[model samples]
Target chain A: MPYSETAREEQPRTPSLTIDALGKKCPIPIIWLAQRIGEVPLNAVVAVLADDPAAYTDVPAWCRLKSHPHVGTYELPEGGWSIHVRRNY
Target chain B: MLSAVEHSAVLHAAGVHERDGGAVSAVGVSRTGAVRVDAFAEAVAVPGTALACLQTANHEVGTLQPVAEVAAACREAGVPLLVDAAQTAGRLPLPEGWSVLTASAHKWGGPPGVGVLVVRKGTRFRSPLPEDEREGRRVPGFENVPAIVAAAAALRAGLAEEHEQERLSALVDRIRRTVPRVVPDVEVIGEDEDRAPHIVTFSCLYVAGEALLTELDKAGFAVSSGSSCTASTLRPSHVLEAMGVLTHGNIRVSLPRGASAADVDRFLEVLPGIVRRIRQEAGVSS
Candidate 1:
């Protein structure tokens, strides 16, 4: 209840799942991505939209620590980074 | 050294024990920002405890620590107590019963780079610096007399401005009362009863502290933020973390000496919209 939930209803064409972590801070974005990675099939991409400064480093670090392949990050129009990671586990 | 902000020097000093193969155990504060005396006792009771340090008040939240009670316990336990008065030197009366005391000049409207370290008589503190005759051989460098003079003058002037201090304190109270009401998802930190008058910290949800600071800076207002994201290291403030408050999107408003009520009003008028804009840009609806 402390974090604001703003799920993006738009469906991506790349068979990827988008998590609206736009307003969430550090650990929350990574936690959400980690917990919900199972929602997408194995090897599918999970994208996190986060504006928190810590996410710029933490997201990649989480992927590296968990041994997932980092798909790359794209700049979002709303002033945050859209980070993608493949569910290698 | 309960926090990394104002009392970083104390923390660094404690690190010396670890470097010498001794361990340093720190006791944290409760949600109200008050450290328990029993915890202090526990930390001191640890075998081979050399010294203990505590801040008189937290720089970020301005919550007063229960220092006197802890000091009494430390004395009975034969542990030297170092009191860091950085946030309380000029703002509040100095707490008694400290074996050693350290304070910064700039925190009390004095010249920067002038700091005070007092060792109570007969405390038997050995000087780490090489032997020198300056300042009774305690500090090795040449005394910065001019800065020390300016620092003393500033302290005198700040102490003499009691009337203006009261007026500005009222202005701070107004901001404390109005910010939460006008801005949603804000958690105002510190205890109202035992807080410094000039400082107020609050965290706004769904906003990046850096963006909010930039907006306020463009709007001709300058304030500090505790959000570690704004700092070079990108770590949250230890003070706010210890208080268990929101670490992101935190703002510290420290009213300058002789700050006027009109200035505070202008800041309050601009803050809500700036927070809203930042939240909106972050794609947060609330």
Candidate 2:
């Protein structure tokens, strides 16, 4: 409940799952990604749309901890980022 | 030492301990940013431990550690305890049972580069440098006589004006309670009570800490930040991270002696707008 609500976003990468944490805060964006990572199948690309400064680092750190491949992070036209992660089961 | 939130001084001291072939133990910190004193007692009780060090109070979050209890634990375990009272010296009473204590002069409104190191009677200590006649051979260099006298005067003056502390404490309390209500999506780092009177810290959600700091500075608020974006390390300060608190957009406000109530109120007034502006620039809706 502390985290902001999530929505889906369309990215050029066409991730299988998109977690929208656009206006959310630090650990919340990280929380959204961790909570919804299981929704997509293994090896699926999950895109996290976040603008939180902390999420820029936390997302990659979370991926490293979970052993998921952090594919890449791309800038968005609307001032945030789209981080693509490949969940490696 | 409590590694989770110690100032870098202790961290580097830990490095020295390792080089000296002594195993240094760290106590975990609670989410409120205080060290786990019970675990620290156990760590001190470990066999072959030579000395344990603890801070009089946490510098970042202003939370006071249970130094007396910890020092007692170290004593019972037969380990000498060093209390780093840099932040609380002259501001608060000294904690009991410390074998050695250290303080910084500038921290108490005195000239910089003057430090106070006191070893309690019967405490075994030797200068790492070659023995000298200066200060009972504990210090190697010639002491700065004027600076030391000025530092003592400043400390005495600070302790004399103890009533000013109540006013500063109130101001800090105002910041602690009002920051969240005024600025949307703000998380105050430490508790309202049981903290150093002069300090308060908070983090704004979705706002870059440096950006916030710049705006606040432009508005005449000279504050410090612990957020990773503000530092060259490119990582959040270990204190906030260890406590699992918001690490970005963090601001630490330390009121100087005789800080005004009107200034604090104005800070509360302008903070929301600053946070909003930063969030907007970041494309955050809130």
Candidate 3:
């Protein structure tokens, strides 16, 4: 168990932060993400949880415009999505 | 100057800038979102107050404004009052003393894409935009003649059905009464009487409004919600917020023309289970 734990800990993973934009409408999630992207360390992933449909496209588009890489999106079980964007800057 | 109960659209028209930190002196509203008359009187009485505008009735909760009183106040103050009657136009009679009245056709079952703007005679209004021939050069564009005809026809039909208004009002009453009783921890907004006939809004505790709305849609009923999660921006409704009501799991049931009693009954019947299931899913306690 110790060996397995050590091996698991050795594997590199992208650092991630969550911005709970759930229950917030469209531009809000984007705005919150924009405001807080600097809080995370460089190359870290920022996941914005939002339910607004506009954010599904807007977040990635914003990342593209801002020149950050959109990592991916994951659906939350309750509702909405956690849109992951990489802080390239 | 403006009323606290004014719609966002009106605020934009007035150029009451939200961005760049611009502000307008605004009148206040009662807990029920009714404009405070004394406060309105004060706001409009200020110097350089170009025009005073208000809605005949609020679109969200069906709360009717004191238009005649406000109109009288405006008249006494020599201020022009622009009444947005989009919600009240076909369903109710317009109160006298508005300098300008505006309405949308779609609100009254008319064709979408058609609107009416009436400037009372001797109002001394200048067109904000440059010259055009159509709409007396007030609105410059090629007229949508087909939509105009359809809108007029729909308005005529809507007005002819005065009895139908009362019927829909009764149906609305049923939902207003039944929703709170059926669903736990619900607050029905708007006055019991003295509200527009067709629209009823309510908020449910411990339920995510968008979830409830989606569940209802799956169950073959369509409704609107004011919950932040429900809106595209995920922002809670300004109307409900202004009314000082619960902002969560809010639902606005707008009974369309020709909707039956059974339809409302089905909605009331289905709503409780939907809320309960959602609460259970979200682990919200009773």
Per-candidate clashes come to 0, 0, 4
Arrange candidates, best TM-score first. 2, 1, 3
lDDT of 3 at B217: 98
Off by over 4 Å in 3: A1-89, B16-23, B227-230
Best by DockQ: 2
Top candidate (lDDT)? 2
Ranking by DockQ: 2, 1, 3
Q: Write candidate 2's Cα lDDT for B111-208 as tens digits.
A: 99999889999999987777878888988878899999999999999999969888999999989989878887677877568888898998776667
Computed on C-alphas against the true complex, the DockQ of each candidate is 0.06, 0.10, 0.02
Please report, as a residue range, the 10-residue window in candidate 2 chain B with the lowest summed lDDT. Answer: B227-236
Model 1 off-target regions past 4 Å? A1-89, B1-6, B227-230
Candidate 2 lDDT, A1-89, residue by residue in tens:
00111112434467999999998866567656766788999989999999876676556655654678777777899998988888788
**lDDT by residue (tens digit), candidate 1, B33-100:** 77767878777767677788888987778788888988998888888888898888987889998999
- What's the iRMSD of model 2? 9.0
| Of 1 and 2, the candidate ranking higher by lDDT | 2
Overall lDDT per candidate, in order of appearance: 0.76, 0.79, 0.76
Question: What is the docking quality class of candidate 2?
Answer: incorrect
How large is the i-RMS for each model, in angstroms?
Answer: 10.1, 9.0, 18.5
Q: Which runs in model 2 stand beyond 4 Å of their true positions?
A: A1-89, B227-230
